[model samples]
Target: DQQVKQNSPSLSVQEGRISILNCDYTNSMFDYFLWYKKYPAEGPTFLISISSIKDKNEDGRFTVFLNKSAKHLSLHIVPSQPGDSAVYFCAASARSGSYQLTFGKGTKLSVIP
Candidate 1:
């Protein structure tokens, strides 16, 4: 079973437009959530995170919202730029002393110039 799922394999948006990415999880035990942006042939870098205690988290142009009731989460990028084009991964962990993260396959975002 996929503990985390990113239904959309890819998304395209014009520069300076909002880009929204969705994600879902099956494990209700998961408590900590994170979003990572990655480029080809490189490791993912942490973008933002939200704890189960909160419903939303934001960082500059990036924002993440978590809905525990639906076991769902989403990432929003405001005024997306060509540089924003890359793979975004949603990850989660159960917060039980295990730092191991469960990641979605990934969603590739392409910003057209």
Candidate 2:
């Protein structure tokens, strides 16, 4: 019954390469998609997010793409660095305007140098 799902539990990428994280959702009512990065013993920090109305959003080396029709989303990090290694969580929220969000299990990303 998990609404948001990250099929891959972990992903490994070479330094200076591109790291692509994928996420899927079963609930069509989701109006927003958010990606969070968590470091060891630290709270998850907001990385990037995309609204359902847009297909893609980019910030520096991070890019997020959303395919509302397919209920799929992805996060791309170019020139992956060791510091970028962390657990990334995909979350979604309905149009209810409430802060409650459905989160995925999260994908652990390891950027090897």
| lDDT accuracy of residue 106 in candidate 2 | 98
Q: Model 1, range 3-67, lDDT digits (tens) per residue?
A: 99999999999999999999999998899999999999999999999999999998999999999
TM-score of 2: 0.97
CA-only RMSD, every prediction: 0.8, 0.9
Q: List the candidate 2 regions with Cα displacement exceeding 4 Å.
A: 97-99
Residue lDDT tens for model 2, 15-82: 99999999999988899999999998999999999999999999999999999888999999998999
lDDT of 2: 0.96
TM-score of model 1 (CA atoms): 0.97
Clashing pairs in 2: none
Residue 40 in model 2: lDDT: 85
